[model samples]
Target: MKGDYNFFSDKKDDPLDAVCPKLSYQQRLWGFLICSGIGWFLEFCAFISFFQGNGKEFAIIFSIGNLVAIMSTLFLSGPKDQCKKMADKSRLISTIIFFSTLIVTLVLAFATDLTFLTLLMTLVQFCAYVWYVLSFIPFGQRMLKKFFSSCCEFE
Candidate 1:
């Protein structure tokens, strides 16, 4: 629709892409906070659905929440730019793992009646999500590896 925010629209034409910015800092901050909050709530509800034996609901809601939460980062960088960053070398592997697991989790939840597989993939998806986040921090993944290795070292 004409009024809807087409987040993927080109920068110069869109006016929200920082090239010729439209949204003010406060508006962007509010948008981020609100979307993140809604995402968190949906994730929480997904947990309830899981325990209530609604596997498909759990998968859909949880995935939606994850997507919404990630989408909130668009407020920090324009949508296309954010997508580029996700596909960049530093974040690529984790992004692939995260998205693939998300798909696997949903498929297992809906296609097969395999609770174990769906749950396992969902857990894996969450871990991949965290890993993807770590990619954004300088040395975060390296530090985590070092920490784990040091903890495992036994003389």
Candidate 2:
């Protein structure tokens, strides 16, 4: 008599399998570097402009803003086990920091001595901030996607 039997049907589901993919080390590193580098460059330009008598107060404020934004972005993007968990939050926080910096600059410009150099530096900083933010969205998305895909593949 032959007995019918089922084999290989006892596999337990893995909790890790259900988790969302995370960014790869290389991708995360690259993204962080790019964001931070741009932030530093913006700050550097602001500092130089301030030394040139281009609204020292405004330049300082804007430079601080850039630094805060960069730090926040890095913190939010740090080695997240789940990328989705922080993506939206990071974007929101960065946006807030960017706008706050703008508001601070405007207030300083009006409240303090608004010189020609100050006006140009402030305007340039604003333009640079906008460009940086806009560029980040796409760059971040691409980098994050690559990171996730690579992570999943690794798994």
Candidate 3:
């Protein structure tokens, strides 16, 4: 392939060709696995910190973990495509909310002494991440909507 052929971009060849031309499949997989493992470990630490009542620690560590986990996607798809997909119209709102809440969560944790508010923002950030991730799955957003409506809808 001359690498000019992005004609079938949605197919596998495009990213493999363009993104990390030097990285092999095994390298990408290994990178993802290592990063994901570290991310999960950090999240576990955040969980422990939450239970220990260290709101500051929990907020910072949890945010880092979430970011690292999201970063793992870069190993699977190149950043350009990943970003384009993230900002796709179908998921744009969720992506905006996720990023906005991420910054807000960090700010609440660092700029104020309000531990409880920091905790609340962290929870909101987590929810935003969930909403953002769901956009990647077909019908994920629709299924969640139906489920929420079922619970909230009144006769």
Give per-residue CA lDDT, model 1, range 1-155, as digits (tens).
Answer: 23545344443434435442456667778888998999899999999999998877888789889888888888866665777899998899898999999888888877898877787788888888888888999998899889899999999
lDDT of each: 0.80, 0.54, 0.83
Pairs clashing within candidate 3? none
Higher-scoring candidate on TM-score, 2 or 3: 3
Select the stronger candidate by TM-score from 1 and 2: 1
List where candidate 1 sits over 4 angstroms from the true fold. Answer: 1-21
- The model with the greater lDDT, 2 or 3, is 3
**What's the best-to-worst order under TM-score?**
3, 1, 2
Q: State the TM-score for model 3.
A: 0.84
lDDT by residue for model 3 (1-155), tens: 54343332445455434555446668878878998889889999999999998998899999999889888877766666778888889999998998888888898888999899999989999999988888998999889999999999888
**How close is each model in CA RMSD to the real structure?**
4.9, 18.0, 3.4
Stretches of model 3 off by over 4 angstroms after superposition: 1-21, 153-155
> What does the lDDT come to for candidate 1?
0.80
Report the CA-based lDDT of candidate 3 relative to the real structure.
0.83
> What local lDDT does model 2 show for residue 5?
21
TM-score of each: 0.81, 0.36, 0.84
**What is the per-residue lDDT of model 2 for residues 6-124, given as tens digits with 9 covering 90 to 100?**
12113333334222124455655666677677767767766676777767554665656575555545433342322333345646554555556566666667666756655665676
